[model samples]
Target chain A: MAKRTPLYEAHVAAGAKIVDFAGWDMPINYGSQIEEHHKVRKDCGMFDVSHMRAVDVTGKDAQPFLRKLFANDVGKLTIPGKALYSCMLKEDGGVIDDLIAYYFAPERYRVVVNAGTADKDLAWMRQQAASFDVTIADRPELAMIAIQGPNAREHFWTAFPAGRARTVLLQPFQAVEWDGWLVARTGYTGEDGFEITLPAAQAMAVWNKLKDAGVAPIGLGARDTLRLEAGMNLYGLDMDESQNPLESGLGWTIDLKDPKRDFIGRQALAALQPARQFVGLVLLDRGVLRSHQKVFAPQGEGETTSGSFSPTSNKSIALARLPVGVELGDTVEVEIRDKRLQAKVVKPTFARNGKAMI
Target chain B: MSIPAKLKYTATHEWAAKNAAGTITVGITDHAQEALGDIVFLELPEAGRQVKAGQECAVVESVKAASDIYAPIAGEIVEANTPAVDAPESVNKDAYGTWLFKIKPSNPSEYDGLLDAAAYEKVAAEH
Candidate 1:
């Protein structure tokens, strides 16, 4: 049997279709996935993302330990409650996992990793902490809830009035603690909202309160579509341990400016020359674009990493890894079964903050 | 669960009903649509195409994955439902009412050989 989240009973009560996702029995959809996608685009929707693990790193050497582990510079996070998106890599520049690290103080930091990679991430963190003076504590007792959309903040504030003061003042990519709950302005969906981490025992009550406040219960299916449209990469689908950040459209996250800071993957990344380019494609035809489909460009053949029909754009969009010679505005052919359909290369972002960015 | 007694069904979850004109209308079953979740797109065979029994003739793509809609019996495609093709979600709304294609069977006995509602329900339940 798959592991169940704290809100599993609530999901069953809402008539959700449950599926096994990364060993967790999660809701794929309540009813229409298209409607759920649009609900997040137009109104407010809440997702139970408790399956993702949050690990707390503390002690005197927390900063230095994370500095050596992450490709992105955690030393840049000077302000408390500021979060940084970084890829934790191995010694050979291969990405182990991409995570969001929130800096609370010099000795205290919290990192949230992907659900599928949680156990591996914790093991890696423990293995790396042998020489450092840091304690890595996995907080499985916490349940995470992501409330997202244009009116998401308002709905969240309505549900939990106690968090209104701090949640209202939260900046993008920032988090605040309120009454033992960590409410963050960061979200996977391209919307203004909060990813609140609270006691797992209290998850059902909060979910019910949000539902009563008119926040629609969204599932993992809509979450995938929303993140894809926002140009966010899913961990295993977009990149893995064999892939590096430079060729995975995550070059901006890597901080190589400081000469003295020698991270785990720094030497490998510095000596390597990236040969592939990651880009976005908008299908010019009627059919949908899917992952692992062959992409034929003027430069060379590549494959789509993630693809789906965007409800906001009313067209199919994809994130593809192509040859470095392929440029923007160029039309590429994607092999969809028997036909090679045409798609236009463009910027990866299709929508953000309830607005179309393409 | 809404299997029509007059219609025939395949183990692959396609339903076929004989019309007054002697041609048979084909569509995915209610159970199939429920399993598929949301129908995003449908790729139907051309009107004049010839098909063999159990041959994969059409494609139905849902949010989850793409599924092949196989031909229930040997037949020639007479008409493809353009409306259903344009709005694929109608299949989810009413699977029986939303016909995918009409076929003029080469041998009418093959259509009769298909499982009826009761037998098809048993097969669907096992799945």
Candidate 2:
């Protein structure tokens, strides 16, 4: 049997189209996915993201252990509740998982990982934490809900006002605690909002309360499209264990500043050269670029890692890995069916904060 | 779910209408279009293209994935749906109204063997 979130009944009552996602019974959409997408872009929407695993790391060696654990240095997080996005890599410089690490203190931190990769991520962390005094705890008892959009914060504040005391001034990538709950000003969508992690028993109540407060219940379908438009990388598609972070439009997450930090895969990442790079593609013609489709750049052959129609832009776009020489504003041909469609290469980002950048 | 009583259906979810001239108009059922939400692109066979029964004749792409549109019976294409190509979502909005392509069937007796509306609805509800 597939696992169910605390808000599963709520989703059913909302007339959601349920589907199996990563061993969990989740809602793909409540009704029209495009309408939900537009709702988030123009106003407010909420998503049940409880399937993602939140692991707490505590002990005197937490900071030092994490420095040695990930490719990107966590040392940059000086303030409490500051979150950093990083990729955990293997010794060969291949990505293990991309995650967000929030620093509460030198000895205390919280990391959120993908649901499908949670088991492997925890096992890997446990194996590495053996040498340190750090404790890795996965909090499955906690449920997370992400309310995202332009007016999301206002609606969420109306649902639970206690968070306002600690989070009223919280900036992006910051978090505050309220009644043992972690309300973080972070989201996967390219919009302003919060991701609240609270006790599982209270998950449904809070979800309904938020809905009563006028927040739309979005699902996995809109979530995928929103993230794709935001140029955010999906774990299974954009980067896998065999793919390098540098070639997956995630080089910014990699810290090459410390040559002596001696993190896992640091040496390999330093020595490894990026032959192909990831860029955004705008369909100049009338077609959608799909994953695994061959992209014939002027320099060399490439492939699209993630592609979809952007509801905000009203056009089909994609993130394709092309030869290093292929820069922005260049033209590339994507083979769709039997026809080669022309597409323009732009920087691999379109929307952020509910505003279109392109 | 809207399988028109006047139209005949196949086990693969395709609906066909027999014209007085013996040609058959074919499109996917409403249930099929609803299952594949928010159509984005469509690739149909060219006019006069010959295809066999149950053969893959066209492709339909939604926001999620791509699926093949199979021919219900053996026939040669006399006309194709050009409007659905540009506005593919019309298929999801009204499946029966937007006919995909017209096929000039080699044998008109094939229509008799097709499933009726009630039978097709039962098949769709089973899943």
Candidate 3:
């Protein structure tokens, strides 16, 4: 039997179609995934993302430990409640996981990792902390709820009236704690929203309250499409331990400006020359783009990492790893079954803030 | 869940409706559409194509995965639904109302071999 989240009962009550996702029995959709996808883009929708783990690091050496663990510079997070998106890499510069780290203080930080990589991430962090003076605490007792859309913040304000004053003041990539809840103005959907982490015991109650406040319950199916449309990358689908950030469209997250800071994977990354380019594609045909499809450009053949139909754009889009010679506005042929269809190369972000960026 | 008693069904979850003109209209069952989630793209065989029973003649791509639509009986494709090809979501909205393709079956009696409403209900329930 797959593990169940605290809101499993609530999902069943809502008549959701349940599926096993990363060892957890999660809701794929209540009904009509397309409608659910549009609900998140146009209005407010709530997703029970409790399966993702939150690891807390504390003690005197927390800052230094995190600095060595992640590719991005955590020292830039000078303000409390500020969040940074970074890639935790192995010694060879291969991406172990992409995560969001929220700095609370010099000795306190919380990092949220993907659900499937939680156990591996915790084990890696623990092994790396063997020589450090930090304690890595896995907080499975906490559950996360991502309320996203154009009106997501308004719905959050309506649902949690007490949190409005403080949450409203939070800028993008910032978080605030109030009444045992951590509300972060960060989301994967490329929309203005909040990802709230609270005690797992309160998950069901909060979910019900949000439902009563007219927040539609979304499922993982829409979540994937939403993140894809936002030009965000999925961990395993987009990149893995064999892939480095430089070739996986995550080069921006790597901080190599300071030579004195010796972070893990720094040496391998510094010695590497990126040969592949990660880009977005807009299908010129009336078919859907799927992952693992062959992409042929003038330079060479590449593969699509993630692909889906974009409801916001009313067209199919995908994130592909292509040859470095492939530039923007160039046309590439994607092998969909026996046919090679034309697609236009463009920026990864197809939509943002409830608007189409393409 | 909405199994029309008048139509015949295949174990693969396709429904076939015989019209007075002898052409059989075919589409996926409501249960099949529900399982497939939101329909995104559909690939139907062109008209004038010959299809055999149990042969995969069409493809329905959902947000989650792609599923094959098999031929219920051997027939010549007379007409393919253009609206369903243009807007695949119509199949999710009303699977029965949005027929995928119409065929002139070579063996019209093959429809009698398909499952009835009661048999199809059992098959759908097992899924």
- DockQ, every prediction: 0.69, 0.64, 0.82
CA shift of A100, model 1, Å: 0.5
**lDDT ranking, high to low:** 3, 1, 2
Q: Model 2 interface RMSD, in angstroms?
A: 1.1
User: What is the iRMS for every candidate structure?
Assistant: 1.2, 1.1, 0.9
Which tens-of-lDDT digit does each residue in B1-127 have in candidate 1?
6998989999999999998898999999999999888898899999999999999999998877789999998989999998787898899999999999999999998988999999999999997
The worst-scoring run of ten residues by lDDT in candidate 2 chain A lies at A349-358
Q: What Cα-based lDDT does every candidate model obtain?
A: 0.92, 0.90, 0.93
Q: Which candidate number would show the highest TM-score if scored against the true structure?
A: 1
With a 3 Å backbone cut-off (N, CA, C), the pairs that clash in candidate 3 are none
DockQ value for model 3: 0.82
Tell me the tens digit of each residue's lDDT in model 2 across A231-306: 9999988899998898998989888787678999888888889999999998998877788889998789999998
Clashing pairs in 2: none
Q: How does each model score on TM-score?
A: 0.98, 0.97, 0.97
